[model samples]
Each structure stands twice: as structure tokens, then as C-alpha cells.
Target: MAEKPGSQEAHLSSSDVSAGQLVQDWSVKEERRARRKIDTSVLPLLFLGLLVFQLDRMNLASALTGGFATDIQVTQDTINLGNQLMFLGIVILEIPFNMLLQKLGPRKWMSAQVFAFGLIATLQVFIRDRRGFLASRMFLGLAEAGYIPGAVYTLSTFYTRRELAKRVAILFFGMFGGNALSPILASGILKLDGERGIRGWQWLFLLEGLFTILVSITLLFLLPGSPDTPKPLLSPGLIRFSPAEQDILQKRLELEDNEKRGGAQGQPIPLKLVWKTLCHYRRWPHFVSTFAVFSTWSPLTTYTPSIIVALGFDRIAANALAAVGASVALIVVFGFAYLSDKTNRRGLSVITAHVCYLVTLIVARQVHPHVGKWSRFGLWTAVNSFAVGYHPVHNSWVQLNCRDPRERSISIAMWVMSAILGLMTGTQYFRGNDVPFYSTGLRTMIIMVSIGMVFAIIQVIVYTVHNRRVAEGKHTSSDGEEPMIYTI
Candidate 1:
């Protein structure tokens, strides 16, 4: 018997619906697998690169007491001048480096930076005087400039805004891990003093610099520009991606980009983009907050070893003890980043972290040397961990607010420049007279972090208001794109 016309129509519609659902299910499954592949393959390589970057950048701190100043014949003042010049180099070169990364892509540009900075770092072993030392530091800074921002911008291309914060934390965990591990590594290498008639500090530079160069060669062969193109320079077929996976990743990002910015995702940045990014008054709160928080690293990171040594420990012991704070930082940074991503509450997480930092700084400043050294050490660890915890949240905030890719690239560069400028002021914080306690520097850090908290508050308020406006359709997007409604 023939089926009725109504029954036939109903059967055809149900079959179409089932077919669509099956396709959707398959796409979702493929995306999950692809993301897992990315997590394992891509993130670890990026983490390694960041680890190399931080090790090279922060080795100078470990070298301070290992006869660096004595061999170079520089006073604390001269060392401070060198630090200032280094940051000045970073400040001057960061934007250009970021623009170059945009032009050349991450693989070639980032690899070249690592190699150049590695060579500069290795050259440090030849510095015979304060002038030579200063020049090497400046050259190192110039070579390392834009690395963090460039890495961040590159990662943003692969991950969604939500997936970014935790990945950023994992990447920065390399820095914290380097801070924790480099002390041990440097101290062990310092034991190689007088081997081949080279000073321990000289060996430190030579070995660490060589490690950076080796890593750069690996990166040159591993990292391709985007997820779509997995072809590394030499690896040819190393990172194979199925067409289905590519379609899912690309389509997902396009959908997200459309929702966030009316599909203004991959447009070339205008020449006036920097001027426009700089003038966005709403972004200033984040900039101020980033600068204030990052500025603390000058006295905090650069001087931690010095402070420990001044507290009656020898250089090796001081370096070992400094690792404790870095250990704490690694824990807090990962934990805080996990929470930030889970809650989608960037501003609250940052403000809370800094508030904890403010308390720890106060306690560290109040610890009396005559009483006990352990209290001072504990408080310093707390301060370091809390301070480091604020970074991933702050970075994600800036990137999310500037949804456009080109805008994000330029804005990240500007943010990094602001951080470099803030850090340049760091050299002045620890003067020759500051010595053991550096009480004034500690107090200055407290005040600066407090100011940063204020900026964090302002950032939350502005972003909240802006989100509300977008929700209510009161104000359109500033860039003539769709207004994105997101939580801070």
C-alpha cells in the first residue's frame, strides 16, 4: 500500500533533521580530538620556547653575586645604569619587533630573535669593563624585545579568547619555572669556576646562551605560523592535520570572531592603529594596572638574590633560597590562571591577587632582620607568588578588550612598552645606599602595587559599564564592528 502524502512529508523532514544532527555530532568529536592534539603538540613547544626566553632574560639576576660586579668593576650605580639602558633598548625596539613579527610571522622572526639574543648573551662573557657590560645588556635587551608580546599574539591566533588565559599562564609558568630552576642551574654551573680559566659568571653566560641557540634551531623546524599550515621549515610532514580538523578549527574561530567583532578579525591594521590604540581612554586603566604590577619586578625579581645575600647568606645559599620564592610563584600562577579561566572573572582575580600581594609586601617590609630571617623569607615568597599571579589575568584582559587581531598585536606591543618603561624606573629603586633591607624600595613597591589595584578597579568598572552599554544597545563598537559583551 502507498503511504499518504502527509506521512511521506513528515518522514522526509525527520530524515533531514537526523542527518544534520549526525554531522554536528561528528564535527564536535573531531574538534575535541584536534584541540587535544594542539594541547599536547603545540602548547609544549611554545612552553619550551618561553622557558628558553625567560632563562636567558633572567640569568643576569643569578650572575649578580657570582663575581659579576667584581669582574666588571662596576658599582651598584653603574649596574643600575646598565639595567636602565637595557630596558631603554627594549622600549625602543619592542614596537618595531612586533611589527616585524606581524610581517614575517612567528616561526622565522621568533627563531631569529632567540638566536640573536643567544649570541648577545654569549658575548657577555667577553665584557671586560662597565662600558662593555652595559653594551651587552642593551644588546641583549634589543634582541629579546617583542618576544613575550610576539609569543602572546601568535598564541591568540590559534586559541579562542576563553582558552587563552590558561595557556598564557602555562607559557609564563616557564618564566616562573626558570626563576625557580635557574638559581639551582646557575649555582651548579658556578661550581665550574676556574675550569678552563674562566670565571663562574662567564661560564654561566656561555652555557645558558648556547642552550638558547640550540632551542632556536629546534623552533625554526617546529613552529609553523598557524594551525592550518603545520609545515615547519624542515619537518615537512611533522604536524599533519586532517581536513576535517582544519575545517572545525577555522570555522569555530570565524564564528567567534564574527560574534565578537562583526567579522573584523583578519583585516590589516591601519597606519594610525597605534595612535588609535594609545588614545583609547578606556584601555588606560589596564595599561596603568599592567605597568604598576610589572614595575614591581625590577626591585622584586632583580634584587631578590641580592636581598637574600645581604641577609647574611653566601652567594650559593642566597641563590638556593631565592628559588623558594620562584617555586611559590609557579604554583600560584598556575592556580590563579586556572581559576580565572574557570570563572571567567579576570578583573576580580587580578584585584584579589594584588590585594594579597599588598599585604605580603607590607609584611615583608615590616620583618626585622634582628628578629629572624625566616619570616622575611616567607613574606617575600608570598609577595612574589601573589605578584606573579596577577600577570595572566591582566594580559587576557587587554587581549579580550582589543578583539581585533591587528589591534591586539599593536596594543600588546604598547602594553609591553609600557611595562618596559615601568621597569626602566626599577633601576633607580635600588640605589647603592639601599643596601641590605632596601626598606625604601619595599615601601615604594607597596605604593606602586596599591596604585595598580586602583587601576584594576577602574578597569573593572569601565569594562562592566561598556559591556552593559553593548547589551543595551546604547553605544556601538568603537571600531564600527559589532560590540562584544564580555565579562572582565
Candidate 2:
């Protein structure tokens, strides 16, 4: 029988196609039960890995206020260069490493990479020159390259698209926690200046690096595999799910994909998948927006403590105080993610978060120099509070626009690479040359942030137009197959 024009049944292969109705078909109660199990089993451990990832990399900034530069005989400019090279390393290897992760499975690959980076992170303690510092940064970046995308890919296999944003937001709390905690920890640890003849920064690296190594071991035992491969690397059915639960976990995702793919499912060859995913122009704004917005973070994160100190706080006080805003950001980002999931409005959520951040920045830039020290501190906190709240929401949005698992992997890798590239460019924003000119740094941040916001709006328009085409049946496969629907 021929399908009628503009009928949802034209695309819905299943009797129920909307996510809400599909949830009913999958059994709302059972989906909830399985998700609860997966949540407790999966998210916490991923958060641990992310926590350490943030700590391992961000410890450098904390080390700066602790005389790390003097010990290594390097200047702030050289440190910036090393930071730039570190992100360059991640960008170069992100895609290839993520592919390896998919091939080998996250169990063996992610576990091994965590251990590898932990070793590199600890080895930074021995660096006494510019060369060694540079070498450590590069090696650490290489080791950490694919972990984010790998985790996201793994999470995708576990959860439905609608559930992804909140989970991702939860996962990223690990990073935010690290950002908030690292400085506070450093303030106390840096006071151990000559403990056993080790400088404070060395102690910081050694203790934190060893802690990450232990976390790697813990994750090996605890991190759950896919629904079918339900055991962690070293576990013997420890985090195991029942057969019925596993069925729910895997089948729900497959069903959701069917609903989205409609009747136009064409499995592209590997090379073709790569090409098509790369050319999916609707996804470009996600990448560009990530690049621009994420660029604004490196300078702020790398210098926030120093900025605080410049506001008349002592180094130790600055380190502890720098954590305040990041702590608040956890609330902000989660609120955005939760509301986005509840409303099923990814674009509006992301733009709202981005605009909030930009408003804070613009207000800060205009009022900053005129303010008193405490007022200056408040503005800086506001700017940091909104920093990167859109990140996880943006990630979920990108994942939604992808057509297949292979495309998803590639798209996520591209998004993460864009973020790393942004960080790389931002390392130069507050280099030694711009050190004294606070306004110069603020201006650079405002420009990058505005560019990102523009791209984010562009992404909304792209999604809107594509969704309209799908509704009208104008969006078609090259072979004139039915159009696939995208979640806007």
C-alpha cells in the first residue's frame, strides 16, 4: 500500500515513533529500572576517569602559582607554548585513538590508556628543564587523547538519545569537580614547600598522579562494559545485568534508531561513512561553536588563580578562592542539561546557556576595571560560573544529529577535536605578552565567545530548516529514499 503524503506513518516503521510513545512500548517502568542500574554502574566510574583527566592536565596551571616555572627554569611564555603543544598533540591523535578504542573495546583500551597517562602525569615530577616539561605535556596529551570521545561513544551504546544530555552533564561533573578541587588542594599542598626536599608542585603532581593510577585500577574492576559485554575488564560478572535488563538496554537503543532512521536506512561503507559524516553540513556549526566557546576556557582556567592573586589575594588564598566559581558552575550546567532533557529542546538550552555566558563576559569587560577588588572578584566569578555550561548539552545535540554509529564516532571525535583546537588557540590569549593588559585578555575572550554564540545560532537555524524538510518529505536520501528525522 502506498503511504499518504505528510503522514508520520510514512516514516515511522514502528507503530509508535515518538520517543514518549516509544518509551511506553519499551515499558517505561522497565526502562527506568535498567537505567537506574546503568547509572549507578557506569556514570560514577566515567566521572572518576574524567575527574583524573581534568586534574592531570589542569594541575599545570596550579603548579604555576607554586614556583613550578622557577624550578624548571622556564618562563610563562614557554609554559603557554607547552600547553599549546599539548592540545596540538590531542588534536592530532583524537580521531585515530578513538577509532582504536572502538576496535579494542573501551574495557581494555580505556583502562590501558588511563594507566598510560597516569604514568606520564607522574613523570612530570622529574622534569627540570624546558625540554622535559614540553615532552611530558605532549606525552600526557597523547595518552589522554581519545578518552572523552571513547566514553561518549560507550555511553551512546548504553543510553537512548533523550537520556543522553543529563547523563553527559553528570559525567562532566567529574571535570568540574576536578577544576574546583584541584585549586583548593593545591593551596594546602603548595604549602608543603620543602617536605622531604620535594617542592610543592612536585608533591602536587606526584600525589595526584598516583591517585589517578589507583583510579585506573579501580575503573578496570568497576567500569561496566556494553549491554552484551556487561563485565568490566578485570571483573568476573561484577557489574552484570540480567538477560532481561540487557535486552531492554540494547533493544531500546536499536528501536530508537529505527524511529529516527525511518525507512531511509542506508548503511554506508566505512570510507563512505567517513566522507558523508564529514560532509554533513548541519553538524558544522556544532563544531565551530565548540571551537569558539571552548577557546575561551583555557585562558580563564589556566589563569583564574593568578587573576585572583592579582586582585590582592595571596597565592594560597587565590588557589582556594579560585574554586568558588567552578563549584557554582556545576549547579548551572546541570540545571541547563536537566531542563534540556525535560523539555527535549537541545538548541534552545544550548543557546540560552551560551548567551548567559556571553552576557556575563560583556558585563565583566565593561565594568571590570572600574570596580573595587571584591567587585572585580565577583565579576570574574560570574564569568567562570557560566564557563562551558553548554559543553555537555552541545555534545548531546551533536550526537543526535548523527545518522549512524560510525558517523556518531566520527562526529564526536570531530567535536572533541574542535574543542582541543579551541583550547590550543586560547593558550595564546593570555600569554606573557598580554600579562599586564587584563583588558586585552578580556577583549580576546569576548571576541571568541561572540563568534561561538553566532555559530550556535546558526546551528539552530540549520536544525530548524532540516527538520522542516523532513516534515515535508523533502529531505531524501541520494537514492530517493524517505528522509530521516533529526531531534532538534
Give the TM-scores of the predictions, in the order they appear.
0.91, 0.91
lDDT of 2: 0.83
lDDT of 2 by residue, 396-431 (tens): 999887766777888999999999999999988886
Per-residue lDDT tens digits for candidate 1, residues 1-488, read: 22232231211221233322311223345567777766765666777777876777777788887978888798888887788888899988888778787777777788888889888888888989988988987887888788888888777777787899998888888777877878878878888889999999999999998998998888888776666555565675356667666655655565566433212123456679867877878888888888887788876667788888877888898888888888888888888888889898899989988888888888878865445777776766677677678887778878887755777888888888878788888768876787777888888988999999999999899988988887788988656777766568
| Alpha-carbon RMSD, candidate 2 | 5.4
Candidate 1 lDDT (Cα, 0 to 1): 0.77
In candidate 2, clashing pairs total 0
Clashes of 1: 0
RMSD of each: 5.5, 5.4
* lDDT agreement with native, every candidate: 0.77, 0.83
Kindly provide the TM-score of model 1 when superposed on the true structure, using C-alpha atoms. 0.91
Candidate 1: segments with Cα more than 4 A from true spot: 1-26, 259-267, 477-480, 484-486
